[model samples]
Target: MECWVPLFEIFLNSPCPETQASLWLQQSFNQPGPTTISTSSFLSLLTKPTHITITDSSSPSHTKRVMWIQTLPNAVQARVLSFLHYDCRRFCESELCQLAETMLKEGEKLDFWVKRAAHQLLDVVSRSNYEWFSSLNLDSEEEQVENEFRSLPDWLKDDVDETDLMLPWLPISQKQFNLAMQFSSCGENDDPMIEFEEGKREIVEQVIEEVDEVIKEVDEFLNPQVEELVERLKDRLLSLQSTSKAVELAGEIRELCKGGSQSLAILGKIEPWRADDEITSVLVSNLLDGNEDELGWRSHILCSVILPKLLVLKEPASRVLLTATIEYCKIHQRAAEYALLLPLILRTEGINSPICNVLTRIVTESLHQGHVSAFCQKLLSNEDDLKKFICLPCHQSLIGSKLVWTDSLFNLMQNILNHNIHLTQDSIDRLVQHAWESADRFSKSLKFGNFLLCFVTKCAPMLKSQKSLLTEATQHTNTLVTKSVLSKLSTL
Candidate 1:
């Protein structure tokens, strides 16, 4: 079946190729054989450059070839279009116009593949020359074609307008068409007057005023209803005693309070002073004391809703909740679950707060490499937090831990140096020593080498002052790291 693809290509390029050959190929594709042509093989065939040279004489043959492709099964045609980088200039003006119409028709389908192909077709049309529109012959007399043009998306019409072409046949109102023509005429003249036709500007202002009124009416109708719903949910939360049932209800409230303004409004209505002390304790315990084997969803829900509501309470109450949560995480080895709340903690309490000291201690003591990696990623992603984290006293334990050679640790180190964050001498010494010890692990050699290159480049002055350590790194087991170190040494 794969052998037939090359023969089909030869037939397409053949001078005066008979239509009968295409019909024969279609029949061969349909016939049962020992090996069936797979989608991948068909994709390879479509991607090959068509060697057919275009000329006035060969235009009809080109159209025939395109039409032959259209005769393929809709599934095959859709797949080819989705993956193929179609060059629109290969098709003649008439065929290109027809292809656009076909793409518009296919765009209406609900199939994933068909929709993808239609999107690809629209991209191709957007990148091509505007001469194809001239071939459309979209005049008032051709009402069917005019209506089809009108049905095209407004974005595509805007794209055409950007070309500044005098396309009077475009499907717009007579007044708009006349206005556009006047603008074009004024642009071409040396000293031309630019003015809207009488009453047109007033009509535009009236439409704008009507639209604004509709928007205000819609907002007035929705805000009070949303506020009322939030108020009821808050009241129900205060009355609930079962932790599981309360969490279930909180999920619905979370959905309504997604945006910042909405969330603050919802939080403002919830009188945390009225929330029962026993209920808050039960929710926090359920969040922090879940089984290690349980999925992370329950913790995520509680941290997102219950934790934020608790933090909204006045000073002593909020500080007590923060202290209790951090202490529970340390004693129960719940660092992985607790990491989920870091973003909220950072936003509310900030990086300099005592909770950050607990975070550093957890990283030093955590058993799983995966959890530490996630925690580091969350910290490194925030520039201000990362700056403070690098300077923490226990940061050396993070750099010199047994899991020091992992990708996340290397990224954390690289980001610290990349930002020119001031790391104490002890931290830098520990990082270099750990790199040397881990360089012989063949699996991580490439990653180790990349980190060393970044380290040497960013900390060149510090490395030069410690010549013995720098010299030892050049003779390391990993050749990539050795080369990088030697390159830096020569420049010194």
Candidate 2:
């Protein structure tokens, strides 16, 4: 068997047609000495061929490999497949689908290894590529195909219980398992293997119990190490003097946090360092002073973990941190970075003078329209916030900005108008003038025309004195705007 591997590669890599080589390999698998080879060596032979195109199961080479696997003795066949299921290199979806079909056709002759291998392959293939399983057309009414199409879980019902084989392959966390269950069905009534006879209710309970036991074991094992690492992080946070050093330390802190709730619990117990004014200042300064590209990882830790925790400190400490953050946004013009701090700023500082300055700068100076749109959507959710945003000192600049004329912003403006929020007369005039300019500039645009129409209809009573503007709009060159204005002139 070991000697045959080199010869197999030589034959496969030769100039001969792949069909002839595949036929020779199939005959080689049937030879008495090679049939007695260990299961590991057999798996190596299957995977070792770099020339084997495993993706196309219908290809002659791939079909011949499938036939070779079937010709192996029952014990060797089952073991090879079972090992293949867990190997580092995975079979493609097409190959797995073919294997599943073969196992299902075995019927009464399906023994323990074959049944278990079939179940494993089906479970993996179904979860990873559900469309293939869904396309099996298992609902066919023909007697023979229907018999072979029986669900794998139903076939394995007598052989294995939930604890023996089912739990081992299930998602470890209850949340992941629940999400999988939600989308795992083939149809309304068709049972996939992920669904047990006990149904989701009981299966979920069992999963929770199993997950708790595993978590408890992990917590017991990791508690001491997490506590030690938390203390180490505290020392590094205090002693680090340079921005580059702090950035390096940030990577270690992020890794510690990835240990999940164990490290968090340990860090939570040691809250004195998180609240220290000196430490908070150092973190904020490093975050602001570090090079933008070098500080990417540290920014996430500071914003998500350090900044939020520091903001809960006393007035003097939190106020100083907020001022520094505002100045950083003003100088760097990093709109995306500033967004990470918005929720904290809104909660702790409200829409104050400093906040308004940064928001105005973002709207006018930032090139990323997506970040600008996100800031607007989040900050202007309610009527009062919307009114406050519209009344900014740079409100005119915002109106003429590129984002204000977009469809999404138009919808936002329409929402404000529908609520009947009162804007100062000057603000209303500037908004209407900007809309008219936009409509005239892009005269053929249906979207801008519709925006102008919405403003005219919704703000009709407020704009009664602006007859010249309405009359000008009536004779607009765009045919859509003219027809729409004519249709609604009586109401106006």
Candidate 3:
């Protein structure tokens, strides 16, 4: 079966006229012996000595290879394809080189061929003096291995059944090995490995640098063909095709092209979409409207670029663009960017977005942080439209959380009142609720210290007109503050 399959493949791969090859293949299939389909038959099938043309002009040779490949038995077709790929790649200028690439690409999809060809190619790359990896034009040895593995047929990818496509070379931890060895006498006592000084920080930096170098190399390799590929990938992400898969594939291709300096040079020319721009704005908007998992990944991607830009874009247009992004983050419940966006949002007006509510909640909840109270106090010092919007809601929200109100709220309230901006209705409602609650619970029962007394003392001027409400609040104020309050009022 194997021998006959290869014979049939030779018929398909040959450039003999289709009519003649088909007629010959019919005869060859009817015969039982492998020798019936001879080399002479293959030689006779070629219409052109070196040039194989097909009816389609756009893909004359590719069309021919596809039509021919269909006639071979699956396994034999794969073997023929392996040899063809080896040859065409070996001699890039051969007339069959284009045909060979198409054949192997298609062959990679067939089940029987994928594993076999992958193993064969992996072995060749691992053991042989393959010039592809040997070229100094390739930047890093690790990168060369990565690309060679990637350029393998898709079925031969690292995670596929053909994972032996690259040797499993991940560094194993010594502690894990020692733990295993402690349990059994027969355990393989591999040498206890030492830490390589390669922590995540160093690895991440190296990967980033490698990626940058690869991008630069891709830019120089860019031709019309490669540009079309980049455009296709970009379009796939833009056109609502699966972005995670596409981005993943794009990342691989980006690394793959790094094999040659020319390829890497071409890649660097390919720009990722800029932050807060129309392209990314549309992307973020669509992504936020997707499912939660999709939104999460998209948020991460956007954060990489947008978070950085939020800190640097001084242009009004960019600021407006950032406002939209903050709103998106808020709607998505992403807390990662709040620290960066909070300061920027604190300065923008005409932007009463729903995100502000989320940000308000974050600020209110973050009082437990050592510096949050201090930071909020500082932000409240300079009164502006931006500060007013942030402060009013934040102060109102903070009153509801015991953690923040304990100390942070008092300090923040004093700061806001000192700015002379009348607290909004929301602020008044929360303050009234808090004061009423405090009076009912604490004002009379406990002795208040001077610090607590100082708060009421400073606020006497503002509360003088609302004595009726204050009298009710004083009833429940902490007992310590209650006496201090009474004493302070007597002095007033």
lDDT on C-alpha atoms for all candidate structures: 0.44, 0.45, 0.39
What is the TM-score (0 to 1) of candidate 1?
A: 0.24
Quick one: best lDDT, which candidate? 2
Q: lDDT score, residue 233, model 3?
A: 54
For candidate 2, lDDT tens digit of each residue in 1-492?
565554445433443222233334446667775364433454444544333234555654442334455554666555545434533133465566566667657677677666756655565565532345555555653445434443344756553433232222221223434445554545778667646533544544544354333223223334676678777777776676675666666556556644354432433333423434434554545433223321132233334344444334333334455455444443433222322334333432233333333333434333233334333443433322221211111111222212224433444444444322334455556566655555555566565566566666655556766656655654564756667654554455
Model 1 C-alpha lDDT per residue in residues 1-492, reported as the tens digit of each score: 356665455444543122223334456668786655543454334443334433576455443233334555566555444323232333343443445455456444435655555554554454434355656665764665445544545656674444322232221233444454444443344344434433344433433353233223222323787878867877787778786775565556556644323343344455333455545554445433223211123233334334444334333344444444544443333323332333333333232223333334333333123334433343433233231211111112222212313544455455444332334454566667766655566334554566676777655556656656655654665555567566776655
List candidate 3 segments past 4 Å from native. 1-233, 243-339, 364-368, 381-492
Predicted candidate 3 versus true structure: per-residue lDDT over 136-160, tens digit per residue: 6656875767556435356534443
For candidate 1, give the lDDT of residue 206: 37
Report residue 346 deviation for candidate 2 (angstroms): 3.1
lDDT ranking from best to worst?
2, 1, 3
The candidate that wins on TM-score is: 2
lDDT of 2 at 191: 69
User: How many Å off is the CA of 361 in candidate 2?
Assistant: 5.0
Name the lDDT of candidate 2: 0.45
The true-versus-predicted C-alpha distance at residue 128 of model 3, in Å, is: 64
